[model samples]
Target chain A: MVISRILQKTGFYFLIILVLLFTLFPFVQMLSTSLKHQYDWGNPSLIPQKLNWSSYSELLGFQKKEVKVPESIHRLLNNPKLSAEKRQKILDRFTSTSDVFPFINYFINTLLIAGTAAAISLLFAVFGAYSFSRVRYRGRSGIQRGVLLTYMFGGVLLMVPLYQISVQVGLANTSTGSILTLVVIYVVQTLPVSLYMLGNYFRSIPESLEEAAQIDGCSRFKTIFLIIVPLSLPMLVTVYIYAFMIAWNEYLFASVFLKNFNEFYTLPIGLKSLFVSKNAIWDRIMAASILTALPVVFVFMTFEKHLIGGLTEGGVKE
Target chain B: MVSHPGSLAQQEARFGWKTVAPSLLLIALLIVYPVAYNLYLSFFEVKLSGQNEFVGFNNYIDLLADRAFYDSLTVTVIYVVGSTLGTTLLGLGVASLMNHKFPLRGLVRGLVLLPYIAPLISEVFAWQFIFDPVNGIYNHMTVEVLGISDERVNLIGTPGNALLVVIIFDIWKNFPFAYLMILSRLQSINNDLYEAATLDGANRWQRFWNITLPELRFVVGAIVMLRFIWNINKFDEVFLLAPNVKTLPIYTYFTAFTGTIEQGLAAAIAVVQFLLLIGLIFLYIRRVLKW
Candidate 1:
């Protein structure tokens, strides 16, 4: 009996380790490859012979190499008429980041777009959820059902028609116009979940608190801001994180609307293009992948409990 | 009666509409309008110069006969089934394992969710590298380490193999969601039932089969259906990893954007997919998600 129990305990731990390895090995490979030199990959070892930070530095613009000056521009830099200061300015202007994948610029673009869309969706969801949960209204349940119905359809089914809308409105023609169109699409994609989450959260807040405030002459809008919003702050953060992750990871509509506008490519688009580009450097690509995933991972790990609670709460009741 | 502004209840109802109008308008314009518009566009021959020539049902007829469409449909069915079943079962296994008391349980629980929460692009590339023919560990393991095969297999380079790989990728990336849902449900199952089963002289497997499986049936069903809906219309997960996988969404994408630019045919495909999804959603909402 003692031997059987010991054997069972060992078997359980063995399975646990196997599960952990399967769950985490790809990440280990990514980090290992990113830190490896070119020749380092020829070996079978998981760790690099030497830890190289060059790819990280290059991608982050901290390498101090500035940019690769094109070979054709060599003559221009050496022209005697150019003063040292003038030549330096010309070099700075002519330095090309297109080949390097412009990680920082794409990072900023993704952060701004994802942040703006999440904030906007959260803001709209708060008001809409309050109305659904608190106020008496006509067609209220019907509208609620309609919104939920909207959540059922697939995004691909909406792509062609939404594409036509953007084109017809001429938003497909310009960079700024395309960015705006992408934002609108993201807002639509994220709003349903935000509404569902915030609406559920709003329903759970006790009516007595709001009623007491109303008796003290608080208006409906004022009570929402003062009582409900403050009370649901954790859930609001949860909703924002959910909405933000959707926009942040989206690639389909981003590809459709923003393909012509390379300058505005989000991280997913930029990263894919980098892989398909002529010089696909594994180290740099892996480094970029790690860099791209870092922020969201950090955010989620920090708010894991809150986010999971909010997600499972909605999920369980449904 | 509620439309009257004179009564306080009516006034309150009016305020509710006022507050909810922006969101309602947004959903109406974006989701509802586009769905109807897509159906309308399916009947036309859409041209590059923004001209539409109405050719009612011709796109659908052509789609019905398209060889690529048939191939894609087969691949999509396989992909969805493989992924949904894989994730659900893997999720059930992992969730059950984690339910047992273990050392560093909290940290292990958090780490298990990494695959689900990581950026899709990052994970896609990681899988690609893992299966890369020249340098990947897959070839190294099979050919050199195990000596099972003498050849370095280029799995992603072949469409059939690529579809399998894509299915595996979807399973790996998405199982945590299933895990999360199932784990939550598993935690809520009453322990007293299990204790009663144990006292009644039942073995672990027998007790689990009787109690745990029954408890998990509804949640597992919901997860499978939800995963089906997701994988059916999935775009980037398949596309980014293996562009040649040729799932329905990628097919629609290629038809609409690349090659011949058959926007009308793509719309036709979308309409069919939309109808299928509505059926699944109703079935899911009415049957599986009733809990």
Candidate 2:
């Protein structure tokens, strides 16, 4: 029996190692591809021989020969005289044959849109979730179902109208407008699940705690603020991260709404532009993809336990 | 429950409404307006360049007569069913295998969600490379290593096989969600139930059939309904992976943007999809909540 157990353990570890390699290999390739030249391939090593920062400089508009350097970066480089002294040096060292990608604008636009949406959705989910947990209004259950139905078509089905509205209101190319529209959609999409999770966590807390607060003559609002909010901080962080990731990684609506205004493009859109030509902009695409994916991946790995608990809360019945 | 006077209940009701007001208003403006507008536009004979009149039922009649619409409807049904079945079965299989004690179990389970979590656009591009005729790994492995040297099969370009391959890709991308759902439920199963079953001389198969299956019915049903609605409304995977085989959403997109900008007809397709989703959501609630 002991010998069989040892064999089982070895076999299990072997399978796990294989699966991990399967998952990590593509990401390693993506990183390697991002660091090499656009036309360069057939490298035998896992790492690039020459560090290619051209993709970074291009996206960030470091190699734009036509467009003048912005004043902020100019001052940052300690060259306030507006002469061609340091600018030319940096340009000569970095500029390649490829056109600049305007990646800095993309990064700012993405952060503005995704960050605003996350904040708005978090606030809405928290307050809305509290009401669902604490109050017993008529048709509460029906209302929850209604909220979930808003997510029924997901993001793609709503694209037609969202596009028309954004275009009509001149909000199509603006970062603020795109972010607000996304927040509007995501709050509705995430509320049902968020409320359901917060509600379960609320129920798990012993009712006597709330009752004691009530007996102390605390108002319902005060009770929620003082007691319930403190208790649910972990879950709140989990919900916020989940909402942030969804908005951050979203591509379909961002694609349609942003249009040809490359100046207003987000990371996902920017990453796609990397693959436009036939020669394959491997390094730039990989670099942009890695940049877009890193933050969410880090957040997910760090808080995976809480996120999973929130997800599976509704699945396992008592 | 009513410790206060009549005014308190009214005040509490007001508070409830106030709390939910922001969410409700957003939902109304974004969801309700767009849906109602789409439904209304579906009945008209309009184009994107701002030209057309109200021709009631003309768009619907045209859709019914269109042969491509029928083909897409059939393709969508097959795609949804095939993807759903494959995802559910594969998910359940993986979940069951991982349920027992194993080495690096957490890492294995987490790594499986890679397809689901990867950026959709980038992943689709990777898939494009993976299936490319010249440099694709799949073809290289099949022809060179397996000695199958059969003619190079253009999986995504062919007529009958393209849609099938897209569905398989969709299943690959989505089954991890089902795995997570099923695995969570699997973990929550009380070991005491297994112990009691064993004490009563019930074998492993009997215990699983009797205890585990009954416990997982609701979660499984929820997963089915959720995946079904998602798969039906899915546009990107079908559009990017198999651009030729026009599913309903893709048809709608092509009609509005790619073709004559028949906005009204596109709106009609959107309305049909939205209504179908609402109906599915209703059925989901009825089926899953009933238990």
Candidate 3:
């Protein structure tokens, strides 16, 4: 019995290690590859032979000289069948020195878009959730059901019309356009879940606190701002993080809407463009990929408990 | 003046609508309007110049008959089933393992969620590099170290292997979500039931089959349903990892934007997808979530 128990314990640890390696190996590969020189691309070893910062420097625009245009873009530009106007446009769009490795721009764009979207959504969701949870209203249950239904349908289904709408509303291929579209989309996409989570949270807070505030001559909005908001700060942070992650990591919409505008490209789009471009620099691509993922990873590692609690709370309650 | 019903309640309701209107308007414009517009566009042939000609279900008919559509549907079903089942079962297994007392369990638990929480582009690129035919570690291991193959195989370059790679990627990236969900529920399971089962002379497997599986059924069901819905519409990972793994969304995207630029056909595809999703949502709400 003792031998068998020892065998079982060994097997368990082995399995745990195996699982951990599987989960983390990609990240390890990415970090190692990012630190590798161009000559080490085909190296079988996971670690770099000589750690290099050139990839990061070049991608982050710390390198002084402009990198040459990829042969593929030049070939496309030189195609005889292509109209001169289209060629000129392509040259204007992609051949700019700054456009070659706009990593910092993309990072800043992601932060701006995601930060604004998260903050705006939190504001809207809080008010919306408060009404659903605390305020007695007509069509309350019907609207609540509507919110849940909206949550069910995936956003990819909306891409086609959304693209068309973006074009029609002058929201395509510009930084402001992408930011506005993302903010609106994120607000709507996040509001339902945030409302659900925050509504439940608000419902759990004792009504006596609000009643006492009201009795002390506080208005309804004042009661919420003074009492409820302070009490729900943790939940608000959870929701904000969730929203921020969604907007930050969103690739499909950003890819579709911002494909024409290199300056407006977010991190995912920038990283993907690097992959698709001919004469691809693997090290720079890997570095950009790591940089893109670093913020979210840091946030997740730091606030993991709150993040998981918020996610599961939403899931379990639903 | 005669008061109709409760005036105070009426005032509260008015105030509630005022508070909710901004959110309602945003959702209406962004979600509700787009959905309705998509449905409308599905029946018309949309041109690049923003011109539309009423086609009256031809797009849908063509979509049903198209070989590529059928191919995408088959791939979608396989991918969704494979991923949903793989993630949930893996999650259940890992969660069960982690439920036990162990050294460094907290750190391990925290690290396990990295794949799910990491940016999708980063993870997808990492996987792509890992599977690259010439330079990737996967090829290197399979060809040089293991001597399993004489020549390096392009895992993400070919269609069949690309699908397999994508399925594996989905499972790997997403099982953490299932693990987290299941683990949370696992922690709340009453230990007394397990103690009772043990005292009644049941073995570990039997106790798990009876107590644990039954307790986990609802949470597992919910996770499976949610994963299914998400995976059915999953575009980013598949597109980024291997564009050739043309799931429904990828197919719709290429059809609409890249290849044919047939917005109407894409809209039709979206409509069909939306209908299928509605069916799934109904099942999810009624059977799984019981919301």
Best-to-worst DockQ order = 1, 3, 2
Per prediction, fnat is 0.72, 0.29, 0.76
TM-score of 1: 0.94
- Cα RMSD of predicted structure 1: 3.2
Report RMSD (Å) for each prediction in the order shown: 3.2, 6.3, 5.3
lDDT of 3 by residue, A92-134 (tens): 6654564367788889988988888889989998999999999
DockQ of each: 0.67, 0.36, 0.63
List of chain B TM-scores, one per candidate: 0.94, 0.90, 0.95
Rank by lDDT, highest first: 1, 3, 2
Runs of candidate 2 with Cα error greater than 4 angstroms are A1-25, A35-98, A166-179, A205-224, A277-279, A314-318, B1-4, B49-52, B150-154, B157-162, B196-206, B240-242, B275-291
Question: Per-prediction count of colliding residue pairs?
Answer: 0, 2, 0
Query: Model 3, range B94-182, lDDT digits (tens) per residue?
Result: 99999999999999998998988889999998898899888899999999999999999888989888998999999999998899889
TM-score, structure 3 vs. true:
0.92
Tens-digit lDDT string for candidate 2 (A137-221): 7766777777765656555456666667766777665766765665566555555566666767777767689889989998877
Clashing pairs in 3: none
In model 3, what lDDT does residue A24 have? 93
